[model samples]
Target: MANTPSAKKAARKIERRTEVNRSRRSRVRTFLRKLEDALAAGDATQAQAAFQAAQPELMRAVTKGVIHKNTASRKVSRLAARVRKLSA
Candidate 1:
């Protein structure tokens, strides 16, 4: 369908961008999942470590437009709360 040169170029760019974004999103989710698993396992130390690792990745996702800022904030807040409860 991309008959024009510009359109063809755009298609290629879109494909590349899609792959990059997909990988970023997947990596973010993997971090989140690790945090969740740590929490579920009731290991405060592991959960804290996972949370520490996930926080920056989630923020990066927000900065990269993969996730909303508030969503990331909410996730971090909730995870932090859970970790705090474990520490208490």
Candidate 2:
């Protein structure tokens, strides 16, 4: 509806923010997927490197409010554990 001027402005702002958030989330997921693919391919060194690359992106997603802190932490933990298993 957004009949009020303020409401219309807010709606526009929300649309812009949604796109930005979606892009950030998508970028983070791309990093995670790359790490997962490296792990699945059984390349320990590549997986380790991919995890290192993904860690900061995931943390940045949390800082930017695109993801929750705990969720990001859990993902990083699980990925690190998998990378460790690969190393062993």
Candidate 3:
């Protein structure tokens, strides 16, 4: 339990931030899922489009502090490679 008013407020703030971060994370995952689906379907054009769309979402999450920069970069790199391989 929160003992003081300040502690209670902090807890409330944390909850709010958690919700926001969760939403951000979910949004990123949704974008990734779209890309994944496109890749799984083996539609190079659709996958390329999805990849283009997903790249910014990943970077946006990074900028928003929802994900680490390197993590986002690595994801982008791997996905780009998959997209390239599919296209080639």
- Each candidate's number of clashing pairs is 0, 0, 0
Residue-level lDDT for 72 in candidate 2: 95
After superposition, candidate 3 runs with Cα above 4 Å error: none
For residues 1-88, write the lDDT of model 1, one tens digit per residue: 8999999999999999999999999999999999999988999999999999999999999999988999999989998999999878
Number of the candidate with higher lDDT, 1 or 2: 2
Predicted candidate 1, C-alpha RMSD: 1.0
TM-score of 2: 0.98
- The stretch of ten residues in a row with the least summed lDDT in candidate 2 is 73-82
Once superposed on the true structure, which residue ranges of model 2 sit more than 4 Å away at CA? none
Note the residue pairs that clash in candidate 1.
Answer: none
TM-score of each: 0.92, 0.98, 0.98
TM-score of 3: 0.98
What's the lDDT for all of these models? Answer: 0.94, 0.96, 0.98
Error of 1 at 27 (Å): 0.7
lDDT, candidate 2, residue 17?
98
lDDT of 3 by residue, 1-55 (tens): 9999999999999999999999999999999999999999999999999999999
